[model samples]
Target: MHGVRIETDRLILRPTAADDFDAWAECMADPEVNRFLGGPQPRAVAWRNFMTMAGCWSLQGFGMFSVIERSTGRWVGRLGPWHPEGWPGDEIGWGLMRDTWGKGYASEGAAATMDWAFDTLGWTQVIHSINPENHASIGVARKLGSTLLGPGKLPAPFEDDVVDLWGQTREQWFARRRR
Candidate 1:
């Protein structure tokens, strides 16, 4: 949580922190924002879920980064390399606050994390486990140059849900970045 940090044109990406909790909880509480993210969670539940992300960093050394706005130092969202136990693949996912929607923050932050996952983490590929109905995420994946990899599976709680996997190989990522 202390060492790794990513800065994009308008955002900073780093591990989740205690100070980010209230904003994180607020984002999780937004029904519209959480609509595709397993629904709004109560503060107590969100706390547990939030700790899961932090735990990943402690144990796995890499997890979703708590996104911050560069200009305002505001907690905007979380997005980055994530592959929890029983996960579908090495995924780069995102979930932002409702107020931050339509601002290109998701794609902007995701692009930086994709680079970190591939170049630093040495991942061969990365995927975005997007809900079929989550058009906004579909658009972000498309914007990142990932193509549909067909329907995918999620573990336990999300196993029955419809998720479309979108991804690109590291080779493809570098090729696209060259242009």
Candidate 2:
């Protein structure tokens, strides 16, 4: 994978590395953390999912960044620009460990990712496919200045699942930044 790194005040966002698998697997195993992300998956399934993210980087040159805490150098979560085949649109998604829930890492990391998507990738717009029941994620989306764009569907196995599309255009994003 090509090197890509983003730094926030307390976080270091970079491409997924081999060393991040254990923590990533642990995060996927937690039911509460995975509740909106299709429930807790076994280690084997987690491995496949992890590889998928890594593959996205190799093939597309962009994928969720392995979010790490700068102070402790811990893998906190993954969040960044992602647009898999059959996805709704250019999306900036996030999933963090349950232990790190209330600290605002999702919003912090997502804010930076949004900037990267629009500025670096030159995306015209960015969307977040969020489960309606996932209030926490909805809150993060709002914090990032994205507005709800009604219901949307995912590809394949998730096609039957319901999600709301929330996002802002590049102009809106830059406008928000000026405020």
TM-score of each: 0.98, 0.98
The models' CA-based lDDT, in order, is: 0.93, 0.94
C-alpha-based local distance difference test score of model 2: 0.94
lDDT of candidate 1 over 1-179, digit per residue (tens): 45899999999999989999999899999999988889999999999989999998999889999999999999999999899889889999999998899999999999999999998889999999999999999999999999999999999988888899999999999999999
Candidate 1 accuracy as lDDT: 0.93
Q: How many clashes does each candidate structure show, in the order listed?
A: 0, 0
Q: In model 1, what are the clashing residue pairs, if there are any?
A: none
Candidate 2 wrongly placed segments (more than 4 Å): none
